[model samples]
Target: MNRYNLSKSTKTALFFLSLLPLQWGLMWWFNLHPDDLELYYSPFFEAISTLQLYSLAWLPFSIGDVFYLFLVIWLAVLIYRFIKFKRNRLNRFISFLGFCALFYTLFNVFWGFNYYRRPLNQQLQLSSDYSTEALVEFTCELIEVANASHLSIVENDTSAVNFNFSKSEMQNLVFEAYQEPSNFPNKLNYPTENIKSSLLSLPLSYAGFSGYLNPFTKEAQFNSLMPQYKWPTTMAHEVSHQLGFAKENEANFIAALVCINSKHKYLRYAGLTFALKYSLNDIYKRDPELFKVMLADVNEGIIKNYKTSRQFWEKYRGPSEVIMKQIYGNFLKANNQPKGIETYSYVTALLVNYHNTYQLF
Candidate 1:
């Protein structure tokens, strides 16, 4: 009882519960208008984008992350052994996770606070003055323009970076494609009012995040922890969130388009190849024959690229990552993302749907 006395988790949750009403009240008091959707991650993202400190950043830290997970578990197990199997350490773990949840809650409140009271931007003007159909059309046109800028719009770089691939060649092709436009960050900038930096880390630092447009900082934070092959896409993805594409799916979609057009070859592959993979997956699920038809359109070099990517990831797979993915999947769902972690991959749907309609709004 003494060990669990002053349960930190309980205390923190209580604090957040106490703050919820206050935050909500303030949002209403300030007349902060929500976006068309409940989420407006742009403000929060702007708060923590001070990642320029890390240049030349991409790294495959997945293996290191696996080792770290083992270290945590090993320490926990040793503590339990020493404590004669008492569960006190379990409570401590919960406390840490709880603290993270609390911070996210406050961070979200801060975002809501700013968004609700934000000065009307051109985006707001577009949202109100244009019809949904009109807005959708404009958005689609922007996407096409973004995509067309990259030669990978119809092709992923297969020959430039030679890798003999296996079953997942398309994946590699996607990555190699993005290398072009990503060489230079897009010259374009989205409508933004303010930028701030924040310190938001997940429980035990599973992933780190920075707010880009919040009351905290101005530029977007970039995470270099992901695989080197996947960095440019993520850079663009985070930037998309900074640009007011709140939903993960929408952000993924925008990031893919933006990177493919980048002057960097890697960035080009990242966008098209990833989009192609998802499109193929969805198409196969809906109609195997159509999926077959689409697959037929892909060239052999593209096939080789996908296979190489699969092989690369296969070499890096570890049990620790599987467990982490399951937990992370749930975490995303709890964070206003209904499809959980799978939502990130659904950007393909938007791409496929876009192609079907020659006449965008």
Candidate 2:
């Protein structure tokens, strides 16, 4: 008779592997019951995230970036070990699977589950569908507001509006904006202040990401190297993610709302123009002639600001950016956003419908 015993590593790996099914089952349940997620899980997330913010917010630099750097290095070492060593190959592969299972579990528990929350449109009581005429009306109003905001910041109609505040100042402004009583129906409670200029700004800019929220650390990381005109809204967007609006379009809509309602003129400009840019793109898709007509009415300074942003991105346009975007798009699809990266533009529907009732200007 021959006796075989499992290694401790194999046992540990099996334990983690056992968790995968439970995690998947819970995710499915949450997906089917989004209102429960919003009512229960969202509040839980807020409570835990507030604690995370308290822990990590005071640091001057991003601990989340460092965590990612170390994670990549660890993965590389694991891969090299797996490839080079022939001994205990089964154990090694199983351990890797265990690590992946653990990571997936932690991600969902900490932040990914928020992806299953009720849609922002429904929460705000805004319609998701709108006619072309309604879009044109909302967009025209947006253009007028954007032009007024641009003129308020700059002397002439031909020059781009400049952001006079530093990154820290911008973060502070966002904090103040969220604290406003009328800005959000529920108090957003942004005092912990975890927003940071990313240490990976150069690489992030190359990857075509404006900002991201770190699920593990609850820090909002914005690419510092991007054009200044993009700063306020980008910061607001990431802050929205930290506040548990996990979907990109929801974050965009929330950010725009926060900024437009801000007392700061610069933030208001950032918000209005940010909304205008998306509205214009939607119009172009639906009716190009109407798009051209509406765009021509926009102030020259706002046009120059748009051109400046385009030229900034144009400098980094390449195959790698496309690949990065495609990967992110697929990731979004896996996380309940079926339209993938197109989900970002879905903010237009929310904006248009919200404006119908609230009047954005």
Candidate 3:
């Protein structure tokens, strides 16, 4: 047989082109295909369920996010060498990546054309014309409705559902601080070295990116410096992603609705808190003073929490975020969202639209 010689460019090109089916399957087909995504993942998740792990942590997303920064750095050096020494293999590889990137961008744009309405009709996410005090009052009232009546709570899903809920017992959970040493679902803690990362040094991540459920470890990481008060909402949002809610808008709506109905006070507030944040603009239009009073009620702890998170990101932020955004914007467009990163804030629209079609739970 003749020596098989394939350039890196050709191999890379082939790999991404093969992934086109995955792109189509996840974006266009799943929504229309009647729970088709779940059908594809049943056996896979069953296997993952056996692992039994939980995490309040994740790999440092800054320099340590999938070793992406190192990969990019290496790519840069490789490109420089190729230009300086005329290496055909490196040139081919770069060419392949460039092609893949271009294709990814176009794929999002094309698919978004058919799916724009998903975002357009989501109005509940647009805040209410209520003050902060009113927000707190309304949110608390909803939680009480869930609590006093014990509306309906089943251990909802048997497999890892990851949707955030207030502690099953409300009063007991309030005073009890969340202990970091709490065991995983089945109690697996070997104590990998934990390091504190600077949030300020980093950049704003893709909103739901923190939701990744590591296929290998079978763990979903949660990192929200926003406050324990804010934790329930973000936690649920991320967990929804872990549960395989791929689309950001769907995850946002599900997270909030789930929390609102949770038994625990904090979890209930967590969902309502997030909803309030998003709905602030609408509230301001109706009553600005109410918003100010609501702002005053915000405990100092919440402010400090934001500070810690900001400082952490400031530690490792640079060009990575913008570059990644540009690349991923294309990917989002390539997938289902035509607006790219802008699709996250649009989740409220999804929430509003869903509520309109279905009676609010």
Candidate 4:
């Protein structure tokens, strides 16, 4: 026997430890060469999406939802095995670390590296800064559009809007939204029927999440518990992820673009409502009095819709949601997103800049 008889645990620990340098090297390279990555990596992501579609698209149910169920079970089994095994604590810990390393490696290879790509704003030349007055102006314009769209839906005294279109129709409509001339950097093979309602709708609702992109399966899964008005926009948001926008605010901004450009009134209303809420919230922080005035300007129908959404979600609030948010927020922070879940709010600046530039409203 050799003098240095390294055990399996020691080898595993050393191997994973060696991988850290490579990961850091990649982070350094990508962070410095994002523009170059944009030029080269777009096709890789498109291929990933197309491959996933061809494989999982035909399934009637969400592969991602099923995957999550399996993942939970697998993790539980791992924990049990670790506790029951007679191995030393250090060996057990090394095994856990090796599992994490493998997952991280797989994640980056599949889709997580998209996090290092150039941001959409830079590619589209959209500025992110605007004056408080400019934000107020955009909020006012959104209020007018939201009022008109809300009126079209309300028709009667009832607050609930009718959804006459099937899920397929809505999916097709969102697809058409991006088919027109747009600001996207590259021509994407627009995703078709790629979004699905999550099988875990009840748990997702309690977790206070509307939707998420499953990177492993390349599926856009949304919570089905929300109202129909939210369905179109949330689908658009998750599909934007499938289009390779990993950042939350960028996905939201792209979803707004897709929705507002659609010919359908419901899609237009959902997009406007999405942008208006962000703009109004930003204005509220800058000047609450102006926010109140603008809020008063919104139509009664829109106000009723907002209240309905609020009341619908309030029932699901609990400690589980708080814990979920904390875990997710930390996950985001560990990624390139410095603001974590708060990055969702950064879409307001994007909306304001876009409105000012295109006079879209």
Candidate 5:
């Protein structure tokens, strides 16, 4: 009897394929033991995050950005080989699948499992449901904070506040702001964590995304071209992702918490302003009359700031941007965000619940 040996490439492919089931099983087990996952598993991942940040977070540029550039070039090379070379087709396809599986596995290991952790409301022991009166009350409070902060910032000749802080400066500020437990808990603390301007900033601007975390590299990247009004809050939101708040709404909630707690006046304004926009929009969707009334109360400087932001985005609006948003929306849904992009607005409930209970305002 002759024994056939499995080729190394075939073995490699099998290893990657087996991880699919292993990952699914781990997810299943974690889901079954939610408390253990939240109490033990999630914190373990956060510690891994700290180790990763200590290793990679201090590079002058985003290591994740370089990795992405290399990935694109590699993908291009594979396509050229598949089309022009036309040899070892099965092996090439398997290699591609293997690469994808490896990336997915690393992503989950590094950051993705936090998706199944307990929701922020449950973790904080706050009420998840809010009365309409509470939402209105919180919105009113945010409006005041936004107005006050808007007035405090220095304005350029054009009447828009000059975004004076460099990206590095803002990143450092973020690191400092998050030191407080109110900003982010000690267990998830990553005081050295940082964000950078996205290497693909122009493309991200057109795609309508303000910022994102590179799960593979543990770096936060923000669109540098976005309006100044959004910079601090957007940066904080991405950092929230690094803190293991995987859900979009939870990240926004954490961002708001960090912002309101910040000593930086601009950050305070940016945070409340961002939250107010969502609260007002949500109210508008349900009651246009109330929305109009709420809008009337917003400070003139804030209104001007909003107009400037609106104008900044207006130039980028088109079919391509809309399509990009749809694709991203689907991606979020696939990752268990049932509301897709709308999940962002759901942060309002968290804001209202925290406000009603804690009276942070």
Candidate 6:
């Protein structure tokens, strides 16, 4: 009996050990052939994600969040056992490696390969480069549209626009926003909507994330505690991930596109202002003086809304948040986003160039 158990353990460890090189080779091959990756892997992911949504979307809460909670607990137990038991240390360590190998394989099969697919701009045939002058012009246009949207919602220009709907209602609106097929240049088929407010909202806020998609379950989880004004775009961003946009910047662009094109006024406002915020930040980086001048032209109400969001995040700012962000940034860097967390702001380039052809408002 001991010999049989030992043989099974050794075979399991060998299988996992072999998977490491095989997974690496697949990733390398996909990275080199993005066109093939897009043609093959992306469609496969969409089908898999659709099935995941079909299976999980009926639940009222985030199953993905629960899965993560249990995952942490399970890992903690494993570590504790390894530390407490000096015997069978090699076997324990091998088991841990096997766990990691399985997770990596599942992650890549589910969503990681999307990172190696063709760039969204190339797929959409939008220009990838723009001059500083073009950026300024687009930013000015966004400011005008955002100001109009804000005024349409509130009586006074100085008063911030408020969402009367609760978070649950907003989630429904996000679903409705994506239902229209004509809203996007490409066919963004979103069937079986599975967005949910994360049970980890408070912890997620402390970790400095607005929302994220669970690769394993294909659930879109947003921070429920975030300011409602930002919810439309943030929710849309996660849904974009479910649509197989793995890059943060591309998801941002798609989210903005969805919101801006929606018939609902609030969604339109959220999308336009979201794009404007990124564009303004980009301007501040390129020419601070120009940004300051442009800022004055935006409505006071819109600026107040931006301040509210900043204050919410500021309340949770800490060393732990910094560390969390650094870790996530490194994860992004490893996944083909060279700019890491900063890759999000690259959405500005896409927004500006997209507007050149699409007419953002």
Clash pairs detected, candidate 2: none
> Considering TM-score, which of the candidate structures 3 and 6 is the better prediction for this target?
6
Give the top-scoring candidate (lDDT).
Answer: 6
What TM-score does each of the candidates earn? 0.52, 0.96, 0.51, 0.90, 0.92, 0.96
Question: In candidate 4, which residue pairs get closer than 3 Å at backbone N, Cα or C atoms, i.e. clash?
Answer: none
Candidate 3, residue 49: how far the Cα is off, in Å? 7.9
In the range 48-156, model 6's lDDT, one tens digit per residue, is: 9989988998999999899999999998998898899897677668777877888888998999888888788887788777789999999888898899999989989
For 300-329, candidate 3 gives per-residue lDDT tens digits of 333343454455555545577567767868
Report the lDDT tens digits of candidate 2 across residue range 164-246.
Answer: 77888989998888877766556667757779999998888788888999998899999888888898899999999998889
Could you give me the TM-score of model 3 versus the true structure?
Answer: 0.51
Candidate 6 local Cα displacement, residue 86, angstroms = 1.6
TM-score for candidate 6, please give it.
0.96
Question: Which residue window of length 10 is worst by lDDT in model 3?
Answer: 177-186
Better of 2 and 3 by TM-score: 2
Model 5 residue 242 CA deviation (Å) reads 0.8
Estimate the lDDT of model 1: 0.46
Of 5 and 6, which scores higher on TM-score?
Answer: 6
* Model 5 TM-score on a 0 to 1 scale: 0.92
Residue clash pairs of candidate 6: none
| lDDT ranking from best candidate downward | 6, 2, 5, 4, 1, 3
The alpha-carbon lDDT assigned to residue 50 of candidate 2 equals: 92
Better of 4 and 5 by TM-score: 5
Summed backbone clashes in each candidate are 64, 0, 25, 0, 0, 0
